[model samples]
Every structure is written in structure tokens, then in C-alpha cells.
Target: MSEVASEVIREMKREFKVVGKSVPRRDGIGHVTGKTVYVDDISFPGMLHLKMVRSPIHHGIIRNVDFSEAEKVPGFVRVLTHRDVPKNIYTILCLIGVGPDEEPVLAVDRVLYKGEPIAAIVAETEEAAMEAVSRVKLDLEELPAVFDVEEALKPDAPILKPWGTNYFIYEGHHCRRVRFGDVEKGFAQADYIIEEVYNTSPIEHAPTETTACVAKPEPDGRYTVYTNTQALFFTMDNTALILQVPFSKLHFVGGTVGGGFGGKVDVITEPIATLAAMKTGRPVKFKYTREEEMRVSSTRSAWRMYFKDGVMKDGRIIARKVISYADSGAYNRHTPYAVTKHAANIAGPYTIPNVYIDAYCVYTNRQPASAMRGFGVTPASFAVECQMDKIAETIGMDPWEIRFINAYRNGDMRPHQKVVEDATLIEVMKAAAELVGHKLPEHLLKMHSWDREKA
Candidate 1:
């Protein structure tokens, strides 16, 4: 539990049903016996299977999409392309005021990545749908693709997004920015400065159950969907917006998920399956194949971070600056918000007087990335903690001493001017250092979290 949660529990003092007590899993027996019904386990009498015709090239211009051969295949029902969708553009995070709807349900004029879905093929059987999708022809004009975040931000790099720039607009700014005190003055006053760079590649969620959804059109003119999505309201609202229908027209059934880890929150499968069901007036089932799940699904973003620190000889962090780039892949899935969150934590938990931060969410010609556990702040935390150790090594000071000296206190101010209160960094560090039997100087060991004067 977090420090604030523990504090809140102590204040409540009346809770005894579940707090701080061991509880049995409610669905353990059903899960162990394989009696729980998943989306794939449910079937309908007139259900049609859906398969996607994914792009084979990374970046391209669509000269033509020829489905003549696909139409001739036996049991072929129909196709859902960009033209069929009510609204071809949307952002998964738009409902939370994060976007201008930057993603397309189906590829319109061109595709941005190798696995971009260009069309959906529906048929009486899943095998027939797959065969039809494989037979669909694509006439594409390949364009040079940019893979690196730094290169994508360069002036000469090819523009991948329709925004005519590789980065998202954070209130008309080039990047999400943080400005506090003067970093130049901080550097001038410091006894020494430390600098380091860190990089991380994209990470896939790879849940045990791949993304799947089944949509059934009801007699009341509403669509009922069964999915494993972690967020139900997102599925309902996004699916309705993509279909250009009212919110009352969609119903979601979920909450029993195999595993999410922040990935299943994506509203990818429900919107298209709902459209297919409405088009055919029959139930539609769409389940991502293992290959599709791995290749086309959103993953954790690749991050490149640059850290600079100014410190005193007495183990005090005086100033800090961070410049981070979030590789958002072909679309701004959730990187814009992630970048903002990353920028907010540029100063970490230390009480630094001067700080400057510029965090960019850059686009690349790869599969669009999205949320995971700690979606935005994890990478920043990794860099911050690692740099603390490096700073100790350079200044010949114990890391615990350095942390104790600058840990946030009640009166300390964040880069955004929010006052820190009840910060436990000092207490946690001392306890952790003791756990490893790492000794520190007596003066530093005397520090406490509640000691605002020492902080």
C-alpha cells in the first residue's frame, strides 16, 4: 500500500470487514474448474466470424484496395473498410479530454505500420473469413519509415502523423514542459554536476487471453457486447462514438478478465464487432489470433531519457533537468498523457530548488503503444533512482546519506508549485538501507521524515 493509503486507513479506525485481513478469492472455484464463461465460450445461432486484412508494409500510400478475389470466396458475407465506419478517426483517450481523435478504426487512404488493419472480412466461418482476408489485394506505395525517437523529432525526418509533425500538441506547446527556479544559477552554485542517459524498448503486455469481443444486436435496437475489457465505460462510449450512435445504444458485459496489466483497457475489438453485427443484423464474434495479438496490439512505449543533476558536497541535490522522449509509434495512443505524467515527475521525490523538464511524445513507424502497469511514471522512476546511485559514486558519498539529505518535507515545493506533505522518502530510505545492513554517518542517520527543519 502507498503511504497515503496507510495513513487514511489509520484515520478511519472503524473498518474491520476486509482491511488488513486475508480474504478468499470469490471466483477461485469457478476459475479452477473451468466453469467460468469467457467471451469465446459464448456462441450464437447466426453468428458470423470476423477477420482483419492487415497491412504488410510499414508506411505507404493506398493506390487501391482490390477485394475482387475475396468476394468470390465461398461463404464470404461482407467487408468493413474505412468507408463503412461512421467515423473513421478517434483517440482511445479522447473521452478523458486527451485528443483530437487521432486513430482510425480501419485504414483509410494509407497504413502507418505493417500490422495496421486495412479491412475486416466477415463470413459464416472463421476459416472462410481468414481465407478471404488473405486473398484481399493491396496496391500500396511504400514510403520511407522512421523508427528512432530522436530521428523522428529531427527536422528532416518524414512526417508520419496527419498533424504534420511527429509530436503531439500539449496546449500548443512543442512538448509538455515544466519550469521552476533557474537551473543555470543552480548549476553555477553546485560543487559538482552529474549527467546520464537511459533508454528502454517497447514492452508487450502479452496476456494469457488475447483480445476478443462478441456483439449481439438486441430486439430493442441496442447492441450487447461481451468482452474482457478492464474499462467498461470506455468500451461503451468509444464504440458508440465510432458508430456515431447514442450512448444508450451500447451495452457492455465484462469484469472477468484472464489478465490485463493495463492492456485490455484498449477499446479496439468492441467497436468493429458492434459495427459488423449492425451491418449483418446477426451476431458477430472477433478474436485476435496469437499473431495479431503479438504484432498489432498496443504495448508499453519505448523511452529515451536524459538526466542532469547539480549537487553540493554535503549530499544535497540543488538542481535537476530532464529531457525525455516517448516513442508513441504510428499513433498517439496514450503517449501524450504519459509524457505529461513523466514531465511532472522530472524532479522525482527530492526537494530540488531548481528544475526544468521537457518531455516529448514522438511518433514512429511502428505499432501504436498504450498503457501498462505504471504507464507513465515507471520509466521516470527507474532513471531517477539509478541516477541517485551514480551521483553518490561520483561525489564519494553514501546513496542513503544523499537521499536523506534531500528527501521531500512538508514545506518543500514541487516544480509545479504543489507543496509536499507527509513525505516518507527519508523514513523509507533509512529502513531500506538498514535492511541491507548498509551503514550511514550518524548525522545523516538522525534525519526523519517529519523533520521539516532538516529537510
Candidate 2:
């Protein structure tokens, strides 16, 4: 190996000491034996339970909200509307560093999606609070709704967030272009060109523990919240910002998380519980039903991709282009970063000379998409890999061989013009192919069959 390669390997092995070591999990026994205290186990003296009232229409103007009947409920404490929430808009995935126009603590004047929170109620009991939430009267003037990104981009479509256009956030002014060689010359030298469109559906996080949080106000004028959150720091930041309180005055504790899978990264039930506690000056607990959890929370974005590739007679790749539209439903959340990552990774693990991509993060009337396991790379890979197989078939080559020949190597520039240094992608691909016995099949046949006659 070269000196540089040797040094890189040494450093990698040095960093691998703790990479795959099997240590006893911190919460193994507590988690399996149900001895751990989760957010749902929290209860405080003189505490109230909270419930939110959401919009039933996909898009509408809020005409009126009446809390008189809710106040008459058996043990109702208070009914909160947008008027009660502070006038501040927040981005749920502000860590990606986008503007504040993406999301808000509560729906201010209009309801863009079917289950957006419009009002909330607190009572001595969860059932009573839910009853009061159901009793609250809301008058909405329904507006025409657009559920698709293409429809939302139309000139005549209704604006989901009137202050902001349907476009959530552009990646950067000119972040979508990547080129290595003369694309016109490369395509002129190509023997064949192929194009395909692919679609991927949105999926849920479906964490074992649904949304739940408990907020307790201390006698010293400080608040502590227990929640099922992935990052305690981000949740603390969101709570402090939303409540207009100092970070020092807020204390956030994450319990043994049942499962996150990138879903528990947002301020959902915690903010609602905090609002109830702050308003009532007492501890408050809020938990979401499975249906409510599905309706109000974010999920993975649906993708529609158009991919094109130019290949030589010997299966060398020349050029590529990808155009994608992502559904950033109801809120911007992580759509900006997600779309940018998709744009950057559109070429997959290939050494394409010319690459161009345009991705739209358009708003629609559904749940806003947040981070998932792959965090926007999976959809791009799905399209590109399928296209790679198609290109291989056209040029009489195996998919694995084509990918191996075009895979990134040391000093190779990626689709976004980033230089690869001492990469192990080729080695990993070789190991994977060896382990999986890579081959193309000529016919579909059952690989395993049960033999009842032997018994």
C-alpha cells in the first residue's frame, strides 16, 4: 500500500477499538423487566391531564373558537387556542439551520392539514380533559385543499402557509450542479441512453412507545419535563424557545426510550404538556392515542423521481440527471435538508461524469415529514440502483460488475464535487457481493420447499 493508504488504515483501526465491541447495554434489565420509569409513569401531586383539539378539515380559515362549553365541563381548568400560544414561529428541524417560516408552535390563523392542533384543554383527569376537548366549539370555513406537491405548485392552488409559498426551502442558490467531464462529449461517445421514473411511499416510525410527556413546575419557578426523546438537548432547546423561558429555568430528562427510529426528535407532546403546566401553574401530563399519534406527528416523505443515465457500449457511465419532487406535508420540518441530501446523493455510488439534479420541497395537506432511518438517502439510492440494473441489462453486463467498475475510489470526486480520500466503498461492496453470492437469475424458481413425504 502507499504511505498515505497505510496511514489512513492505521488511523481507521485506531478508531475501531470501540466500534464493534459488545458491552452490556445500559438499560437492558430495566427495559426488559419494566422497572424503568418512562414518561407515562410520571405523575405529580395536584397535576392535570391535557388533551389537544385538532382541525378536521385539510385546509380552512378559523372563523371562531368557543371555550365556554369546555369551561363548563366537570373539572376543566382552561382551554387554550392560538391566542393563548405565544406569537412565535419555529422550525421543527432547526438544527439543519433553516429560516423560521417553516413551522410554528401552533396553527395561528389557518389549518393547513387535517389534524393540526387548534385548541387544547386541561382537566383534573385525562378523560375529563379529552371530554372538554371534544366539547370545545370551532367554526371553520373550508378552503380548497391540495394533497400533492405538483398541485400545490400550480399557480391557482391554495397556499398552505400564506406567509410562505408551497416551496419549503431551497437547498442553496446553486447547490444542484455536479460535473467532472465534458458532458456533451461524453454523451456523444455513449452507445445508449436510458431513462426511468421511480416512486417510493412514505412510512411511519411506529415506535413502540407513542408520544408521551409530563411537565412538572417546581416551587422554585422552574419546570422539568420527562419525555421519550432521542436528544435531550434539542428538546430542551425547543421547550425553552417555545415557552419563552430561559434554558437554565428548564430541565429536560429523557426516560428509557422504547424506540425512536428518528421520530422522537421533534417537540410534540412535550410542548403541549409544558403549555398546560405553565398556564395552570401545576404539573401536566399528555399522552397521544395511536390514531392521534399517526395523525399529528411527522413521518418519512414520499418521493417521485425521474432518473436518466447515459452509458457506453462497454457499460461505462457518461452522464446522469435526476429530478425529484418530495412531499413536505403541512410543515417544512426537515424537508430542506432532506431534499438537499437527496440532490447531493442522486448519482448513488457511481462515478458519473456529468450530473444534474432539481429537487422540490413542496408543501401539501398531510403530516409533515421528519427524519427517518436513512434520512433522505434511501429514496435516491432506490431510484439510482434500479436504474443501474436497467442500464446493466441494456449493455449485457451484470449489475454488480457495472457498479464495481464505476464505484468511487480514492481521490475520486463525488456527484456533488466532493473529493473522496482513502475510501473503503469498493472493499465493502466486494465483501457484500461475496457474502451474498451476487448473480442474475434466468428464471424464477422456489429456492426452499417443504417435504411432507420425508416426515
Candidate 3:
């Protein structure tokens, strides 16, 4: 072996403590014995249970809100509307320079999706909270609703977003766009062009533990919050910002989570519970039931991706254009960022010479989408990988052969003009072919990441 390769292996071995060895997991025993202190496992004294009064309409203008019946419910402590929230509006990604916090923690003048939180009730018991939440009356004027992004983008379609547009603005651009090289010329020079569209519906996180939080008022004036949030500091910052309180005033006592999978990334239940605790001077606990978790919680945005590719008979992708829409449901939770990521990665792990992409985070009359395992990139990969088979079928080439032919190599330019370095696509594909015993033509079998395909 070459000295450099040998040194790399040595370095890799040094970096790993459990490689090729039967090392026991550190936390497996504790989990198996039921000793983990998940957020749901905790309890406090005099804690008020909370529930939300959600919107029933997909899109509507709120004419009136009545809590008279809710107030009469036994053990009903308080009901908070959008008016009660100090800073009613916040985007979950605002800390990362994502601007114009469009989503209200509570529905303000309008409801854009079914099951959107319009009011929160805090009571002495869970039943009381549920009863109070159910009794809160809303007078909503129904509006024309669109579920599809294409439909939502039509000139005559009803706008679901508060910004008067159905889509998120990315640095003044209507969609997250990426362009590089001469795509028109590449398409003109291609032997065959393939256009394909792929779609994925809203995916739920469906963790063992649904969204939950507990907020406790402390004697020192700093509120203690326990939640299963994926990002603690982000949640803390968002909660503090939404409540219009200093960040230091909120103390986060969390790290244990049942399962998040990026669904817990949003600052959902914590802010409301904290506000309720501050108002009532008592600990507030809020937990979404299985139904609420499935209905109201953010899911992976449904994506509709269109790909137009310029390819040679030999399987090299010369040019590509990806137009995709992430159905952001009613609000911009993390979907705008997901759009940017989709724009960046839509073309997948390929080194195309010419590329153009437009990714939109669109509002629709559905449950808002936040984050999941891969967030935006998984669906992109799904579309591209599925297209690989389509491309092979179109040109009568091997599926794996096509991947190796178009896979990224060292110093190959990407869609954004970033030259790929140390790419492993060719090697990984080669290994997969070997493992699966996929037979490739002799010429195609010789391809390598370090060298161009001569087949």
C-alpha cells in the first residue's frame, strides 16, 4: 500500500475506539432497565395541565373569540389568545438570519390550516383543560383553501400566508434558486433529454414520545422549562423571544428525550406553557396527545419535484433543472430553510456541468411541516435515485451503471459552482454493486472517482 493510504488507515483506526471490536454501548443497560428520565417521566407540585383550542377550518378569518363557556368550566384557570402573547410572531429559524417571523404562536386574525392553535387553556386537571379548550368558541369566516403548492401559487388562488404571498421569500427572491454553467447549451447538445416528476407526502415524525413540555415558575424569577426539543438553545432563545422575556430569565432543564427525529426542533409547547406559568404563578404542563401529535404537530413537508435532465447515451448528465415545492402548510417553521437546502442538494450527489434549481417553501391548508431525519435532502435523493432507474430504462442502460457514469468525481463542479473534492460516490456505488452482485459491462465496471468514465 502507498504510505499516504497506510497513514490514512492508521489515522482512521486511531480516531475510533470501538472499530472492529465488541464494545458495549454505554446507555443500553439504563434504557433496558427503564431508568431513563425522559421529559414525560417528570412531575411537579401544583402544575396546571394545558390544552390548545385549535382551528377547525383550513383557511379562515377570525371574526370573534368567546371564552365565556370555557371560563365557566370547573378548575379552569386561564385561556390565552394571540392578544395575550407579548410578541405574537416568530419564525423558528430567525436566529440563523431567517427574517420576517411570519408565524404567530397563536392564530392572530386568521387561521391558515386545520388544527392551528388559536387559544391555550390552563386548568387544575387534564380533563378540565380539555373541557375548557373544547368550550372556547371561535367565529371564523371560511376562505378558499388550496392544498397543493402549484394551486396555491396560481394568481387567482387564495393566499394562506400573512405576507400576502403563498411562498416564503429568500433574500428577496421568490424561491431559493441556484444556477451555474450554460444549461441551455448543454441541453441543446444532449443526445436525449428526460423530464420526470416525483412527489412525497407529508411524513410524520411519530416518535414514541410526542411533543411535550413543562414550565415551572421559580422563586428567583427565572422560569424552568423541560422539553424534548432537539435543539435546546434554539428552543430556549425562541421561547424567550416569543414571551418577550430575556433569555437568561428562562432556565432549560432538559437533555433527555424519548425520541425527537427533528420533530421536537420547533419551540412549540414550551412558550405557551411558560407564558401560562408566568400568568398563573404555577407550574404548567403541556403534552400533545397521540391525536394532537398526529394532527397538529409539524410533519415533513410534502414535496413535488420536477427534474429536466440533459444526458448523453453513455449516461453522463450534462445539464439539469429541478423545480421543487415544499408544502409548508400554514406557517414557516423550518420549511424555508428546508427549501434552501433542497435548492442546494436537489441535483443529488452528481457532478453535472450545467444546472438550474428553484425550490419554494409554499403555504397550504395543511399541517405545517418542520424537520425530520434528513429534512429536505431525503426527498431530493428519493426523486433523483428513482430518476436514475427511469433514466436507465429510457436509454436501456444498467441502473448502477448510470450512477457510476454520472457520479461526482474530484474537482467536478456542482450546481452552485462549488468544485466537489474527495467525492466517494463512485467508490460507494462500486461497493454496492459488488455487495449486490450487480453485473456491469466490462467498460462501465472500470469507472473510478479519481478518473472520468471512458465508457
Query: All candidates' TM-scores?
Result: 0.95, 0.89, 0.95
lDDT of 3: 0.89
Error of 1 at 155 (Å): 1.4
Q: Give each model's whole-structure lDDT.
A: 0.89, 0.77, 0.89
Candidates 1 and 2 compared by lDDT, better number: 1
Ten residues in sequence with the least summed lDDT for candidate 1: 446-455
lDDT of 3 at 441: 73
Better of 2 and 3 by lDDT: 3
TM-score of 1: 0.95
lDDT (Cα, tens digit) per residue for candidate 2, span 1-455 = 35998899878877886664576888888878888888887788898998888899998888888888889999998876666666347776665567655565667778888988887788999989989988888899999999877788888988776554777544444223445566667667778888899988878898878888889998898888888888788888877777678889888888568788878877777776887888899999888888887777778888888877789876778888777888878887777788888878888876787776778777888888878878678898989889989999989987766876676666668877787666665567655655788643422111111111111
Better of 1 and 2 by TM-score: 1
- Residue-by-residue lDDT tens digits, candidate 1, 383-430: 998999999999998777677777887767899789888888877877
How does model 2 score by TM-score? 0.89
* TM-score, ranked from best to worst: 3, 1, 2
RMSD of 1: 2.9
Per-residue lDDT tens digits for candidate 3, residues 32-140, read 9999777778789898999999999898999999999999999999988888999999888889989798889999889888999999999999999999888888899
Off by over 4 Å in 2: 1-21, 171-186, 438-455
